[model samples]
Target: MAKKSGNAFDFGLFKRLVGYTNPYRFTFYFVGLAAVLLSIFAVARPYLLQQAIDTGFVPKNENLILEYVVLMLVVLFLEVIFQFLFIYFANWLGQEVIRDIRVKLFDHMMLFKKQYYDQSAVGRLVTRAVSDIETIASIFSEGLFMIFSDLLKMIVILGFMTYKSWQLTLIVLAILPLILYATRVFQKKMKTAFEEVRTQVSNLNSFVQERITGMKIVQLFTREETEYTNFRSINEKHKKGWVKTVWYNSIFFPIAEMSSSVTIGLIVWFGGLRAAEGDVITLGVVIAFIELSQMLFRPLRQIADKFNTLQMGMVAASRVFAILDTDARVENKGTIQLKNISGAIDFDEVRFSYLEGEEVLKGVSFSVNSGDTVAIVGATGAGKSTIINLLNRFYEIDSGTILIDDKDINTIDLKSLRSHIAVVLQDVFLFADTILNNITLNNPDITEQQVTEAAKEIKIHDFIMSLPDGYHYNVKERGAMLSSGQRQLISFLRAYVTNPEILVLDEATSSIDSHSEQLIQDATDKITEGRTSMVIAHRLATIKNADKIIVMDRGLIVEQGTHTELLEIDNGYYKNLYDVQFSTVTE
Candidate 1:
């Protein structure tokens, strides 16, 4: 999980985010130039109106008035062009930078250790990857560049007003300090509110995602009203988060509007008094100052809003950088790479714990020769499945060594080591794709024909062809369209098609019906024939044919031998387990 910063503006995060725009530097520069041009052009219309009123219309010169009007039209056209350029390039730069960031974030996620994911929420990560990145995009498209443009326009307008008449300019700016003070307060308050909004959004997404994923459980337990009540609480928090922002906006904007109106009133009254006192100020100059005042103060209001956008983007960037800066990735420094392995595994006094001080595998030692079938049976929490995880290096061992074909597993290339092994767990996951694609997993080297051939060898090809679309049939999300047994058969076919030298089946048949169990048993026998296999089964009757049976109790191997040898032991753990299961079956 990424830790968020408390500061409103994280300059460290801002600097790093700016680095992602390096690839699009040309577009960024062009947009900046357009912003400057837009500011210069934005002030032209008012200046032309002043010229028409003072120099042309007042003296009754038709030619001069017509020329001024024509010039104003030309300036208006140029402003339109510059405005278009500013908008298009700014959005383009934002999209390009966000696209790069998204790709980099996803690639970084791929290298993170499994433990990082174990403690992180899926919905929070999704928010970072999707919604949060979109928020950051507004920093360019709606926030930063627009702020620059508005600031520049204000400066240019101020310059023109002072040059025309300094005293009137000062009068128009009488309420400026009050507005600035209000804006500062609004910005600070909005920053905190926006952060709260983002937090609540992530919480809401997480809650909704989990509830939907586990809707079956909620309905099975008749927990609809309870879950709905929980949802309402979270939804209220989400609403309140946004309502705070609205409260600030409601308070600030009216004050800003009133201040602007007051400044305009002061300009009009004072300028009228001067005009009545025999032309110390002209109508054209007074009107121009009014327009300039609007040009100056409107951006003050807009800048406050844009700053809110900027703050949200900064918050999002801080969260995103936390993920980017994580160092909890799997280390792969081994130089050894093997194309083929002999599939001999040795676990020498291996010790491990998913959590500190709660040992799951306590100095356990075991070995399997090439092409040997080993079955591990134990009670729940007896560390039967931990062995499979350790063998695959899904979690590192606390002490001792794991080896494959006499080479330390840690010294072998991670990809090369895993390429030779396949795991089929009790809960098999299938993507929402066609059956053929799911089986080969988009491996170009493994053809559709090859998948069909593999399924045929396992005697499940006919079952697949009976479907409406056969190999091309869609399995839907998590294979929800298929029965548990059917999904397991798909898992078996998928593993068989990989043709791994080592295969692991962790309670693969524990959840299926008797018919599906028979089919899986047939497929299992075929797949494990020449491969070094490890079977973890809850049903004691399934492992009768294993070459070696290792019975475990409380993270220690209590007995080991073939089924008959273990059964010969008097009142041993394996013998007792066998007796209980045999009696249950006979009854």
Candidate 2:
């Protein structure tokens, strides 16, 4: 874990940024060389001017004049070439670094336990992935290069001026300390302003994304005016943030420009006086000092701009680090393989909690034999799905061991454990792709024939065939083109295609029409014929044929046995749930 930086401004962002350049060492070296050549060319132009004035024009040497002009052109062309090469390679390196970071961020997000997602908004993650990467990429591609080139130019120009004439150099250097102090002050203010802008932009993104995704709900509630009003308020905040950013940027550039101009004016006055006093300061040297003075201040302005940019990157870096450094709540200690064995599951003295003080499941124990269908029936929030989630090891339990075929699940590899089970959740998500690709999930090795077969077995093949492109039909984002029932069928086929040893259906058929529900029921019955399966549902009809039914209330199993046995008990919880469904069946 990174200890928080005591100061609001993170000086450490530079260190982290530099670390990303490790992979592109060759690019860095080449860019550094190019920067050197570019700075050298800048200093060379001033000297060329000095020579042309002192020797060529004074002596009326046409050949020297022509030679110097041609030399300047050649140096200018060379500088452009080097600049192009530096930018090309630097951008390539920066993009590659950004790509790696984005991938790492995605992988890290996955490793974070479900609770993180429960609290974090989609827009925030999207911003980190897209905008944050962009900021860092800009820092790498342009910001770092500007900094390198500017620093090189500043040092080279200053060093040359001092070497040619120390007295003038000392006089020019008088105001540099003041310039540095002013730059520091400007940077502090600009950084804060930009940071506020970035944060507001993220919030605006979140608000927009949430509103768009839930637009139907908003309309149904007749809250369009309210949403619009809220949106206006956020937009106002965004406008304020943007205005502040512009205000700071506007002030920063003018101050830097004025400071540079003032330094040049002071240099000219003092240098001209010294020359007039017969101080042996040639017109050529004085001209060179003027040019060098301008060159020196250009980089100072660049540093001011880059300081603001670095602030945004640093803020993003801290967020990225927060994610990277977070501990994953789900622990995967299993490495042992459980292959081609009987699928028998046992939950022994299990205890689990999502919150610190509120236990979701306490001392729950159950045994499921191979090929047995166990149904878990409960009210909402009664820990039915939680039991199945544990079976897949989506969340680690607080205590007690879950066993598979008498082997503790902790001893099995996570991949192997998950590979042996398939889950169909209440809400199905389908990627935006061809129907076939969505079903296969880009498993290239899975044959098209197998894909069709899976779809057919789940009774979705005819519907897919009715589409103009059949299996090649593209699913809209999140399968928006399909009805909920159709989407659920595709999801079932996807899970079935995996041919898992264990199947978990969590309220899988609750939201579909009666006919679609029957189809799902048929598919479920066929799929679970010889596999270890657990069904968590509110409808008693869905689990009537289960080998055993476990009824839960308030995180504890209130009743257990066959459907008839639970109905016979006639207790409030299970009896009420069964009576509702049983009455519907009778009607």
Predicted candidate 1 versus true structure: per-residue lDDT over 474-539, tens digit per residue:
999999998999999999999999999999999998888777877888898899998899999765
Give the top-scoring candidate (lDDT). 1
Estimate the overall C-alpha local distance difference test score of candidate 1.
0.87
lDDT by candidate, in order shown: 0.87, 0.81
In candidate 2, what residue range of length 10 has the lowest lDDT sum? 1-10
Candidate 1 error regions (>4 Å): 1-8, 275-281, 539-542, 582-587
The digit string of per-residue lDDT tens for model 2 on 1-587 reads: 11243233564666776787898888888988888899999999999998988789878999999999999899889988998998898788778878888888888887777777877889987887889777877666777777788888999999999988887788778867877877777767766666677778789889999999899999999999999999999899889987986887687678767777787787788778877787867777889898998889878888777766766667676667677777875677877887886889998999999888789999898899999989998878899989988888777789998999998888888889888898998899998898888878888878789988887776767877988799888888889998888888888888888898899998887787765776777777777879998998665556788999988887888888887787787466677887776557631
The model with the greatest TM-score is: 1
What would the TM-scores of all predictions be? 0.96, 0.95
List the pairs of residues colliding in candidate 1: none
Q: How far off is residue 492 in model 1, in Å?
A: 0.9
